[model samples]
Target: MNALETNGLSKEYTGNWGKRTKVSALNGLTIQVEHGQIYGFLGPNGAGKSTTIKLLLGLIAPTAGTGSLFGISIHDKRARERVGFLPEDPSFCAYLRADEFLDLCGKVLHMDREQRKKRIAETLQMVGLPDKATTRISQFSRGMLQRIGLAQALMNKPDLVVLDEPLNGLDPYGRKELKALLQVQKSQGKTVFFSSHILSDVQEMCDQVGILNRGQLVECGKLKEMLPVRNVRLKVSTMDMDTVNRLEPLVASMTREHHHWIIQLEGASRTDEVCAILRGHAQQSIEITRTTETLEEFFFRRIEENNLERGITRPEPIMAMAEA
Candidate 1:
């Protein structure tokens, strides 16, 4: 069975007392995530990414539709028994020490004293805060606070981890460490589902991704399959000007790199013809590399295309996470 599933999940909020403006936060969103994969939920501002997450975690009831975690209905408390979550913005007991706070989290999961002790130690170390266990939560830096939030989430050794904007407020090194930690979690057969504005990190970490826009899922599939090979390149030893001239028509762009010639082609279909000219006819030794459309590029183009088809004239503010 899939680790997570949502079918036609929707959420709408009624207007405030004075106004009759109902807002559709999420609309007919459907997705399935398999076990042990890092699924990146992506979207532009006000796209309902957080709303969908809240629905999936049972923090709020969906206005319509159903969802399940490991075959258990999301509405059932048992569904959350082995699930861990880190909210986009989390507040904690500022006076409690890091260890103390994690101990409380473990207690909520019904772990015994010894169990809590073991996990508090383990998770602190897992999040690179082993030395700060005795430090007060009020004293930690922003990055440190995020680390502790993650530590609390993992205290239960959950089977599935759901994170909203997990990469928010981390420095370069912190982001690197957290990405590595998430990969380690997947290596342990735990499923990871996270939303982030860091497209590069999501591209690196997620095997599966779902792009949400305007409260609906615009795209969802295996990352590799979703990004097609868009460009082909060949680097080779110096070629005769005549041979290069013969190849000029088929190549999109040609340049010299150090002592070699580097040529880029528009599509994978040109690989054979380009190679045939370089290797078979020209007899030049060549190196071939295919590049795909990057997640960032795809994201912008896809969202823009979606907007255009719907007659939205303005470009979207893709990186503004606060409104999403």
Candidate 2:
């Protein structure tokens, strides 16, 4: 059975001023996360990413639809008892130590004294915060705090782990270590559901991904299935403005730096024709460079395509896993 499943889930909030604004934080969102899979949920601001997480966690009542964890209704306390969550911005009792905070979370999960102790120790070690267990929450660095947040989430060793921007405020090293921990968790047969705004992290960590925009999930599936076809980059050592102008419109875009021109083609479809065109007017020798599309390229391409389809403009593309 899937670890987490949602069918037409949605949430709407009512304002304090009695203004009738029906903001659908989640609009008929439907998704399913399988066991041991790291499902990456991608979206722009106000795209209902957190709302879905909150609904699945039973932190708030869903305005519409239903979801389940481990075949149990999300509204059931037993279902929540089997899952763990870490918010993007985690805050605990500032005066309490890391160990104490984790203890509190363990108690909330109804763990016995002996069970909580062993689980807390293991989780702290798993997240690389074992040595700093006694350190107060206020004294921890941003990276340290993030790690503790993860540790607390794993205190009960729940079957489904949902992390909202798990790498938020983490340093380069911390991010690496946390990613390694996530892999270990998956290897142990646990499901990981994480949302991120960094495409690279999602690409590297998630087995499957879903892209959301304007409260709608536009794409979903394995990364390999969604990867675009090969594309080539051309570097021509030419100073003639006429040759550059001639090749610019034939391809996607071109950049000129000093006497060298960098030309980018969308795919391998007509690259041979482009090279032949460049060769006809080359004032100097040119070099050909080839590279496949990375996860970021795939993400940007999807976002651009969605914008064109809906005729709605968006600002610069949001970076995955990087946004708070």
Candidate 3:
């Protein structure tokens, strides 16, 4: 059985007007995650990622459909006991020390004296906060708070760990440590469902990905399948428009400058065909080049498509996306 499953899951929020107005946060979304797999839930703002996570964790009720964890309904006590969650913003009592917070979590999980002590030690070390165990949460940085949150989530040693925006507000070193910790979880056979707007992180860590747009899942598949195939790109700088017109069919797309044509050819078949087509117009000089699309490119294209479909104006890239 899948570690987690959502069937026709949906959440609709009614406006104050009571005129039967509805906004579907999740619209008939269905997904399954196997044990020991790292699944990336990716999307831009307002894509229903948080809604899906909330529904799965039973923090909010689904308008239509059901979700199960470990073959049991999420609302069941058994299922809730086996799952862990860390929201995007993890806030707690600032007066409590990191260790104290984790102790509370263990106690809530019903761990006994020896069990709680041992688990807290191991979890603190795992999150690289063993030294900060006694430090007040108020003194901790945003990144440190996130680590403490992760440690608390792992206090019960859950089978499934769901983290929303795990890398948010983290520095390079902190992000690296978090990624390493996630790898350790994977090695331990724990299933991880992580949400992020950072495509590069998702590309690196996720085996499977699902992209949501405007409360609807626009794409879902294995990482390799979802990524654009690596292929050659040619920059055909020519002064002739007639030659560029002939080359359009052989290439995926082309951009025309005042006196040059930039053609992008994908895959070997198309590359060879494009070369041949360019050779036929020998009068026009053809510059054959090769380049592969990055995961960021694929992500942006998908986002642009979604934006265009909704007639939303595209804005400049977010700082994270641009840097990635």
**What total of clashing residue pairs does each candidate reach?**
0, 6, 0
Across 140-200, the per-residue lDDT of candidate 3 in tens digits comes to 9998998888988888888899999988888888788888888888899999999998888
lDDT comparison, 1 vs 3, better candidate: 1
lDDT of 1 by residue, 21-83 (tens): 999999888899999999999998788988988998989899999999999999998998889
Candidate 2 residue lDDT tens string, 175-199: 8887898898899999999899878
Which pairs of residues collide in model 3? none
**lDDT agreement with native, every candidate:** 0.91, 0.84, 0.84
Show pairs that collide, candidate 2: 196-321, 197-319, 197-320, 197-321, 198-320, 198-321
Candidate 2 deviant stretches above 4 angstroms? 231-292, 315-324
Scored by TM-score, the top model is 1
How should the candidates be ordered by TM-score, best one leading?
1, 3, 2
Q: By TM-score, is 2 or 3 better?
A: 3
